[model samples]
Target chain A: MVGSALNQIEIRRLVKAFGNRAVLKGVDLTVAEGEFLTLVGPNGAGKTTLMNVISTLTKPTGGLVRVAGYDLADGAVAVRRQIGLVSHKTLLYDDLSAEQNLRFYARMYDVPNVEARIETVLRRVGLWGRQRDPVRTYSRGMQQRLAIARAMLHDPPILLLDEPDTGLDQHAAAMLTDLLHEVGATRRTVLMTTHNLDRGLELGDRVAILAGGRIAYQAAKSELDAEQFREVYYQYVKQRV
Target chain B: MPLIMPYLRKVFAIVAKDVVAELRTREMLSSMFVFSLLVILIFNFAFDLRAENQKTLAPGVLWVAIAFAGMLGLSRSFIMEKDRGSIEGLLLTPVDRSAIYLGKMLGNVLFISVVEIVILPIFVVLFNLSARDLPLLVGVMILGTIGFAGVGTLFSAMVIHTRAREVLLPILLFPVVIPVMLSAVKLTAAILDRLPFADVQNWFSLLVAFDAIFMALSFILFDYVMEE
Candidate 1:
């Protein structure tokens, strides 16, 4: 199983420390190819830090991280080519239209057939009609949707999302949920972190909770429903604190 | 040629995006143009001019204007990216990190050159200078701006995340480029005085050397600085 086709991400004893304070302490986790793993963690649990590490946006203080069969330290550019990250920031230029923004990233990633891909992704996000409008004019939901389209431009097989559904209303949240499910169904490996436990359990094939910079509790999602997972999460975090 | 073409395209892509953004606002260029005129106007009024001494002081005045105005453009190059939250997105691209440095450096150089081009005629009119060596003066100005833009681009990236970056960037940048500034001022003086090219060759070579050294160091060290 170590080098099997199913293995997309493997982390062993990951540690990230800023000065004397350690934020992620010897965290170990693995996500199989085409599996959707949702990580639920309390505030300050280092979830974002771990996502940054996997995307190679942040380097680790120590330990091993390998994504898409390449080591993190020596293979950053290679790793970047294989993953797309959606963080809190939309990462879109406010002045550039959605089409221009996608075109810019498509060129950066050297994505072939750039125009067609931009159109397809814009259509998928339900923003094709407004492609020429500056992203500044976009509503929060529309901008978030454009952000997702930007990530999908390069079409990397590994997707890392950090709190992607943080600020959406119910209608937009439902749209995002549908999009996430479609993305997961397309045989891509996904690792997501969220505070919404109900959505996390519903979407994840496996659920992992991080506390005190470590994996506090992890199990198959089918083994615990939303109510049981809440009890487990609170009790586990309370004991650790 | 084919192998290097893609990298060149990426470099130009970044510059194009920046150019498009700047055109939409015209903020950086307008500020630099206005500030350049203000500096020369202030110096023109403040100084008691002897026509003979004006030739002597012309180089210092020209470079001082260019350097100060160019610093504003350079700081805005990366600061705008950081402010709009696009720097991280730029960083995650698959190309070498040095490509981003080169692209920003090129954008900074382009903005400086544009402002300097506009300011040159104003400079000549205000200082009452003749056109004996205008071509040579433009040549030296280009060289001087390259070194200025290179060092400024490096430091602007370093200070992008810091507080009061407006105050911090100049403080960090001014001391480091003193050599380039001195060489540039000397070259400008030599050209304005219409001294034989041989007299200023040393300064010209030194400016080129400074530019080359700074560009190499900035490109080599930027990858390490960008990685967090």
Candidate 2:
């Protein structure tokens, strides 16, 4: 039961609203560990808001959210400790060196052997040489790498990426995909939001389209062809609009 | 200790990081220091009163300068965090939201303390009077700074999303922080004139009350201000 519980994130009838405008309406989802789940949606389809809810950054207006076996509403702190997020924003201090930023976060996370861990992660992200420089001096690609480094520093069992490829070039995006695969191989569950359909399908074990604040379509990559997936997505979005 | 220890550590780490960054850049403190001195200089010239009259007016002038200068420091406190998206990074961590608020408020307190330390002596030299009640003056400064920074940090988080952040901070803050300013001025006047503590006990209580109220309010409201 513990093993099974360790491998899943469950959301049921989740609803979130800002004022009277509802963003997520009775959305439901389940993701297994080691599964690369991609949430693809058009703008304003509540993808980010749903992600925020799952990450415990935003509370839901209604419904159940459980991540890594912890209930979001009741065990939010525990749930948060098990999840890591990378978003379009770098979320690093420009004045601090990359290493300092990582060390700061590592201390915040209370990760043991912080110095060794920061060195290893910076090297993994190909940022070791520039780790001493302030983040403001870093290129967009470098900052994204540092952001990824920060997210993975605590070694959470789950990862959430919100358009992680937004500012990256093909080379960087390819590296990110490889990193995602490596993380997934370690039996960590991954939920990502992306606009890049090809990249999403290529990396995801299961691809989901969020529309009208709900999951309009979801299936394993092997179950659907690219053309069919695109057609389904287009129709779903069109009908919702 | 329980898990809150880690969150507290994170808060202190953030505070330390801000201090180190400010030390290197000297951006926030220098601006606050220079602006405060300039305000005092302006007050000296504007009043142009004799020493007998200056004693009575000094407390009001000193606090006004501190208030305006403190606002400058408070507004800049979160600019780097918002600019580099560090707040989002912070939210991603497993720490409690109130920890972030406390850390940022403490950082503001330290910065304001630095400004006050420098300005206090300068104030004495300019006004040609000794601050005989230094301990009470410091106490009032701490209470006033805490109350101001607590609310200022929260408002800064709110206005970072707005178009006119600089203008919005004072507009939103000044009305709300009236109690803090009133208590500070009253306490300062009492101390400056060497009044008995019993006579000024109400002012001290008011200052403590304002600090507690605003601190709690800011801690609770911070999560809302941090939301995307």
Candidate 3:
């Protein structure tokens, strides 16, 4: 739904293993340049592993992954420039203030106009006032908000979020939902993994289920309502059992 | 020139982050400094460090304090990163792996050097030893620290994800850094004795060589070691 013809993420027969155990069996998927794709799977479905591979945090055991038109192996740095990741962990230094953390990453990314960009992102996340406070002093929701600011600091075109709403309260979750809606409105390519099927369906323009290390079902929001998607999701789970 | 500037900026960013964090918390520095102070204190009380046998034993005592304290600092450097999952934040950046290693290694060097600088005068005063060659004694300390931090940084990264990282770091580090330790202890003794530069030139060269070799090897291997 709401996508260009260009594919932002291209995976073909992707396989990831840890020593003797295989986490991600051969899988294929493609996300369009402006699509918000929500990926849902049961625990141990390798959603995080898949996200790690796409982010270049974990190397794939086999097959191929191309992000933003660059192969992961051939051009990981280039790919890194195009993508931002918000994992379950904040990936932030708790000892650092939000501003300092953002500044550090800005310098690492070689972002131009660093100070101004930091202010804009902080303000966008409603964290401009508390930017000077150490991250550890913030609530879980505040930290997660700061994390989103950090990820978007460089204004990357693609975002990868893995369970960002985990450990959040209802109020914080609603705040995150508003922020994610704003993020979705910007037309950036997004791939989010979640256990909350309703949230996933609500936020994503398209929803896909990953079962047994592969994409088991996929449909656009226009084609599948929450009831229909739940039926499909449980069908896949039943099949797995 | 243009290419290297950005790369250097990235390296400096990491160093600045570590410095600011350390300054704010002082966890690693305070522990390392107190641990070194304790080592010197225990040794001072335990041994009669009169000038007679002091020349023979002082070098060992000084290097031992520095080495053990440096190990503590090194283990902490990465453990902090791993504990908070910030290492993943670092690895997710576009910077080269070598930049991360160099940044961390330099931070380790800075911390250990600060401890050494403070403790050296205490060491001299407490042991009642005359360090006439103060400058050269410091040079040896810095050189030996470079080598130690180089290898120690790599090993720290390796053991960071392990359950018993604190115990494992010393085990893995002590053996590899033997050359640096020996060369430093010998050169420190020779300098304190006011030996001619020619007399201890070989040891100095060995220390220099070890520093270079350790830094180069760790730099080359960091990329592979960092892979998840």
Candidate 4:
């Protein structure tokens, strides 16, 4: 039983509500190590709420959450240390230079060799060239890249990205896809939420269709075609509405 | 040893960063200096004090200028952080939330101290008074600024997210910080008049007690304010 409980992320009976409206109603899911799990849902399906709960950014009304072998309720701080996040929000200081932003986070995380780590991450994210420029001077794509650099600075084992592709152009999106692929290849667990079905299908190891605050359908990339996935997705949305 | 060192270092780092930024921009200090000078100038005309009248009112006018200018500086402390999204960045880091609070408080204290340092000489020149009890006056300034910053940091964090942030900071802050201001003004007056320390022990005790209580409360409640 102990060996069987190897999932990197696990949720059981996760329920969240605001006022009388239940956002996530008795939802359950598990993500294994190195799994690239993409959650695709309509606007009000509670994907972000679930992500927030898992990240310990929001307290759930009810449920169990475990990340990186630590129970969220019991070891929230440890779990937070293990999970890195990239949200639609850039979360970068606009006035600080790119280098300062990374250095600030490195100090916060108490990462060793902070200067070297900052240099390496900046180079990896293709921001080393513009490390001295204030983030306010960065373009949207550049800012997102720096955000990714911040998230990856600590080398956390799990990454939760909420629409990491929000404002990127085609070239940037492709680059992001490549970066995600690189991250996945290194065996880090990733849980991402997006409305982009085609990219989600192409990048995800497993695509999950969330509707009515529950996962209506989940399939490996090889198991579902685009048309089948779309039909089922739309059907669930219509039924829920 | 008490896990306070790292937080203190963090606070110093933030203060240093803010000092450097301000030195480069002169945004906060210039505004505070100009505004404080204007307040003192207005007081000069309003009170219409001759040489003898200046001595009696100088302490009150000096502190009033410092307090108002300090509030202006504290109010803007988190505005830049929030506007630049730096607060969220700090929160997402694995550092203790209390460290962030202390760090911000220290930054505010440093800024207010700088303003006070500049204003002290100006006050002396304006009122034509000798800088008596230099060490004690400096001590009072530090304690007073700490108390003001402790309460101001907490209120600023609360109002940073509110719709009426600019208006809300003073509204929530003034009442809570009144005890510190009262104690500070008394102590400053006592020191300026060359009064005995024992005579002002009451104000000193009040200052120490207010500083301890508010600092502890601010440390504990900071986590809730920073929660996403």
How does chain A of every candidate compare to the true chain A by TM-score? 0.97, 0.95, 0.97, 0.95
Off by more than 4 A, model 4? A1-5, A18-22, B1-24
Candidate 3: residue B155 lDDT (0-100): 95
Ranking by lDDT: 3, 1, 2, 4
Docking quality category of candidate 1 according to DockQ thresholds: medium
> Which lDDT tens digits does candidate 1 get at residues B65-103?
998998899888888888988888898888888888989
Among all candidates shown, the one with the greatest lDDT: 3
Residue A2, candidate 2: how far off, in angstroms?
10
- Residue pair clashes in candidate 3: none
Runs of candidate 3 with Cα error greater than 4 angstroms are A1-5
Q: Write the per-residue lDDT of candidate 2 for residues B26-110, one digit (tens) a residue.
A: 9899999999999999998898769678778888888898899889988887766776677767776777788888898999989
Error of model 1, residue B24, in angstroms: 1.2
Instruction: Kindly give the stretch of ten consecutive residues in candidate 1 chain A with the minimal lDDT sum.
Output: A1-10
Write the residue-wise lDDT of candidate 1 on A85-201 in tens digits. Answer: 887788899989999999999999999999999999999999999999999999888988888898888999998889988888888888988889889888789999999999888
Residue-level lDDT tens digits of model 3 in B62-160: 999999899889988888899998988899998888889988988899999989989999998987777676888888998999999999999999997
- Cα error, candidate 4, residue B64 (Å): 2.5
On TM-score, the leading prediction is 3
DockQ of 3: 0.87
Give a tens-digit lDDT track for model 2, residues A130-158.
98898889878788888889989999889
Local lDDT at A108 for model 4: 68
Model 3 lDDT per residue over A50-129, tens place = 99999998999999899998889878888888899998899999999999999999999989999999999999999999
Alpha-carbon local distance difference test for all models: 0.89, 0.86, 0.91, 0.83
